[model samples]
Structure formats: C-alpha cells, structure tokens
Target: MLSGLDPSGGAGIQADIQAITSLGCHPLPVLTCLTVQDTRNVYGASPVDAELIRQQLECVADDSTIHAIKTGALGNAGIVDVVVEFIRKRPDVPVITDPVIKAAGGGDLADDALITAMKERLFPLAEMITPNGEELVILGGDADADRAAQNLMDRGCGSVLATGGHGTGVHIVNRLYNHAPDPMQWEIERIGGEYHGTGCTLAAAIAAGRATGLSARAAIAQAQNYVHRAILHALAVGKGQPVPDRGIQWER
Candidate 1:
C-alpha cells in the first residue's frame, strides 16, 4: 500500500508501481496520501480518503496472493491508524514500511503527532521499517543509528533497517538491526546521488523480493542490491529530480 505520494509518475505510487513491475510483480497500490508537487520536493500533501483507501484494498485483497505489502509516506495520525490497522490484520504478510517524513529535496511531510503515532503504533506493526536519517531521529529520539534502531525495536519492530543515505559521510551506511538478538550488517557506497523515488524503489523492491518467495533477510538484501543498481543507472528525467532507470531490469 503506497502512500503519502502523488501520481506524478516520478515518485511515490508511481515509482512504487514501476519498481514492483520491474521485478515482475503486479503492484496493487492503496494510496494513503497525495502530494501536490513534483521531482524536487513536496510543496503540499493530502491524505487519501480513508474510506476510499479501504475500498481499494478490498478490491484487490481477495483476488491476489499478495505475497508482500509495502507502505510509504503516511503523513497524518488518522491515516497512520488506518494503515496500521490494515497491516495488523495481515500478520502473515511481510510488511515493509518506508517511513518518509521528509522529501529528498527538502520538505516536511508529517508533524510531531504523526511522527509520534508512527513510533507508538506503526513501528510495532512493521516487520521492518526503512527510515531515512531524519525520520530515524524522530522515531528513535537519538541521532546515533545504533541507538535509534534499538529504540525502534523497543517499539516492537522485528527489525529496523536504518538507512544512512542522508547522513554525513563518504559512504552510505545501510544497517539491518535485529533488536532481540545481536546481529547487524552495513552497506557502504560512495556512488549515489540525490535521486528521486529512492525510498519508494527500495521498499517496493523489498516487497517484490518477498512476493517472489524471499525471506525477510534475503528480501532485504536482494532489494537493497536491486535499488543500488537502479541508482547506478539513474536518469536525469526532470529539471529538479533524477529518476532511477528502473525500467532497465538489470541483473546482479
């Protein structure tokens, strides 16, 4: 269920659909929010009609195997409640939550209450939350990636894959943290840009991997690899943002 993005065909549900299809999975989108901006950043956002959101879900739920589910940019508290409740009912499916609180080009997508809702409710329902740096700070209450991940786990996430793409460093550090046990891994790379649709691409790739029968860990790894490759072949499609060449189906 992709949310908090517009149908600009550049990011959000548009990007999610492309990423999912690139991996040969049909994207069944339940848009949770809508935006009024483009590639550069979001200028304004509106949550999708709650009842309409449910109707869309019902339209596809009974007819699909729905191997995995992914969520992005739910900008408000009420909508978060609806999404959390939706996922809660589907416990067996792997839920990939991309906590998008801000845009890559710079903008606020959620307020304190919405952020708090994510921490207290949505975090627990998530199998794994792929949060950007700033979102992590709000959810974890600490800038330290390790500490923030633990805080997310304490809120009930089975795993918190804290993405460090926004953090300052020569290499990007994407860490998968299992709070219950002591296991973690990081991916470092210096070759990436401020690409558009990055979060949607990653989360949808994970969902696509899961739909194709990958376990949580395997799905995460494969999805990360896929997204990395997509970034490597990103295209400057817009004046403000570059879209990943996800259309090119590359192999690793």
Candidate 2:
C-alpha cells in the first residue's frame, strides 16, 4: 500500500492498515508523505523523497509475494512517478487506487502536477480507481458523471468507481464503469454525520477482497458493505468528523 502517514490515525495509511487487516490481509505500507494534522483538518504535508520511496518499495517487493496494491494520498508528482514505475513492473497485481486529492476536512493533499501525473501515468495501471464525486469532476474535467467516467476510461483506467459520499442526496449512489453497456451501481442510504477515512477504508477493503480472489464487481460490493458498516459504528475521536470504525466487529 502507498499512502501518507496520518498522526491522528483517523485516515491515510493508518486507515489502510485497519481495513486491510480487518479483511485478513497483511498490509505492506509504504509512506508517500507525512501529514501534519488531526482528526479535524490537515495543516500541511511533506512528501517523502522519491528515492526513499523507491527503496522502500524495493525492500517490500523483495520480501513478500504481493497480492494486491492500494494507493492513497500520494503527495506529489515525483512520488507518483516512483509509484507508477514500481506498479508498472507488477502488471498482474490488482491495484485499487483511491484518488485522494483533498483531505476529508478540506485541504489539498495533491497539487495539480500530481493530479496530472496520476492521470497521465498512474491511473492507467490501476485495476480500479475510486474517486468521490468532486474528484471525478476534477480528474475527468466534466460535470456529467457518465461523461467524466468515460473520460477517465479513455485515459486507460481499467474501471472507475465514482463514490457519491460527497454528493448531496438521500442515498449515496456509487457507480462503477467498466465499459459495459450499463454501469453497476449501489444505492446506499446516507448515514448521517461526517466520517474520516471512509475513502481509504473502502479502497483498502476492495484491494483486500481482490487479494483473496474476489472479482472486481464482487470486491466492490463487499467493500461497500464493509464501509457502510464501519460508518454506522463510526468513532467520535475528535471535534470534526468522526472516524470510521474499520476495526469494528461484525454483527453475527
């Protein structure tokens, strides 16, 4: 997994670890950046050196049989380039990319150059790219969801999972576009109260599911269900937005 380090443990690589572990996969996290923030907001971020990230990737690859890759909050174009190159060599690995452009409480995590790098290089290698509605608009440069998803597909992304958590509605509608005649969608009832790390958890869960041999569609469904449950049991750890209970026990 490639992501930033969150000191608060509400999101970033911390969330990825929780979600992946909850789903029975051991997480091999490589920090792309270090964030200065709490549960309320992100004050700033410092990206890790590209060479250091490369070394970490190399070390992990040498020791483990990686089953899947999950990425979140890559801080800059240089880090994106490093990650893209590493992923390029592992063509068979299923990659679930959470395009975290902005923090949950409103702070830019990635700049324009990094976004461009992701679109031009990283996104194409992904098995699935999970973007919230606003991110879809920015990445695809289109207001129309379908058009935006199509735009991303044209850029070589294998599939796009456009999350609706940022959209205003009675139900959160998550749509998956994979070049089929019709997209697969799930209408989840909106759970009230803002929650941190939902995106990271969702993407990580999907990657874990994929690692366990679930198909893309099945993994998405499983992840959606997992996130919904996590949100329902969200933890009120700080002043702003609650954190998803990624480690919450399932109701038997």
Give all candidates' CA lDDT scores.
0.79, 0.92
Error of 2 at 218 (Å): 0.8
lDDT of 2 at 115: 95
lDDT per residue, candidate 1, 45-141, as tens digits? 8877777777677668877767888888876888777777778788888888888888887778888888888888888877888888787877888
TM-score computed on alpha carbons, candidate 2: 0.97
Task: For candidate 2, give the lDDT.
Answer: 0.92
lDDT of 2 by residue, 126-240 (tens): 9999999889999999999999999999999999999988777789999999999889989998998668888898999999999999999888888889899999988888888
Give the winner by lDDT: 2
Number of backbone collisions per candidate: 0, 0
TM-score of each: 0.92, 0.97
